[model samples]
Target: MIKQIPVLDCCTLSGYKEDELLVDHLADYLHKHSSLAFPHRHNFYHMVLFTSGGGAHAIDFTRFEVRPMHMYFMVPGQVHTWEFEGEVNGYVINFSREFFQSLLLRPDFLNGFSFLNGIAQDGAFQVPAHMEEEMTAFFERIYEQVNRVKPLQKDLVSVMLLYVFMRMEQQLSPAEKHKFPVYNYTLLRNFQKLIEQHFTNLRLPKDYADLLYITPNHLNALCKEYLGMQAGEVIRNRILLEAKRLLVSQDMTISEISDELSFNDNSYFTKFFKKLVGMTPEEFRKNKA
Candidate 1:
């Protein structure tokens, strides 16, 4: 019998339950007929390092062939499913909202890579043969720290993981790294993170500025400079994207999507959707369907 797997929740890692970090030797865990799928509602991000084998991985409606030495990253709320045909060896790092918030606050660390945002769409990092030794060394250090006996070893391992990510990010092209501004990049990153976290509850630019301890004008300037759009436009785009996703991907009614997004009423939400999307929500969903 094919075992029915429950949907994995976001905000917490649910599928692989072992608390201790260890290398998952794929031959031990994967079954020929079994597959893994994640929940599409809650928001928790994941970074996956695939060291061997190949498979098909799906994110939302997008699918990719997972080959050896490729790094795959998935954002929260993106529905993901995977099937393996052969050996699968990898490390998956799951981090919570607080973890990402703290990282975004460090400007020097995150500002140089605007290409990171594009990772969801085209974000696979191919491990070069020359770089493989360095990558292996870094992963070994991470695994050692993760499995260490010290009480604070996990925290230390988290820091090492960030370092590893930085090293990997450095391998990207200069054009990719320069996608966003370098100055106040930290603030803009934080704002984007906040918007991702609170898009349903807060849509105003001032709300984000207040949380980041900056003026709305400053936030607007950063968005215009780096994102090539106004700050409000980014927020609205996120909201509308979610609205359309829920509309087409799920059975949620139009009123429910509207209410979930916190509009005054369905009519107002419809107008908002129409203004930006150039089509009503119903029309967009219908066209997509």
Candidate 2:
């Protein structure tokens, strides 16, 4: 167990590849980058469509079985590790955050797909049987263009990728698409951003509410409406998540981890972890180990 999780970036993983992008058959990709079998996080957005596999992989702390035609989308800074039983093959597309930004008018175009969101469970999905042939063909086309770059190769790739995302979106039920109003959804995302940035130092939802220029009650209402949790709960959940991520590595002691998260003390942090997780930090680490 290393003291810190490895955060991988595009260039380091891309190697001889250019253009801030990596496209390859998963089996071939893994053969060359076998070190990735260990737990790690990536700086670039990552996705994989497993055509055949067994066993399971954990994204963050939640485990999902490797399945045929299943797609996993990962955002930057999320820890992922895989345990495989036998052969596992698929198409893995890893690209820098800017891979699509410069090509599209909307800077946050990728976020429109819920599967691209940082949540562990939301990032994993199984494509329908009918769509597998078309999706695999799309992946193949992107792979083919890698070696035979045309004048506007990347532009073509971006269009194909966006179409793939749109097809995925089309599968969602109407109810899932319109759960939160546009304004409230934007506000909720803003609130989440603030929490992500300040969760270590700011413990209260009002602190985030102030940053968002919204009242605490209003912020709470948006969170409750969109996330099914109170604003405070959302903030606490972020802090707890960071704590769990930190605990995964062995470098930090309980006291050090508590201090790192701005906790009042080791005992308080232990109680908080137990109250929600049903196990002490040490116990959780041991069990996972």
Candidate 2, 49-80: lDDT as tens digits: 99887889888988999989988889998988
Top model number, TM-score:
2
TM-score of each: 0.61, 0.87
Off by over 4 Å in 1: 1-23, 26-35, 38-45, 52-65, 75-78, 83-89, 93-130, 137-163, 169-176, 179-182, 201-218, 244-251, 267-289
TM-score of 2: 0.87
Query: Candidate 1 at residue 258, lDDT?
Result: 81
Error of 2 at 239 (Å): 1.1
Cα shift from native, residue 15, model 2 (Å):
4.4
Model 2 alpha-carbon drift over 4 Å, by segment: 1-3, 104-109, 148-152, 172-175
- The candidate maximizing lDDT is 2
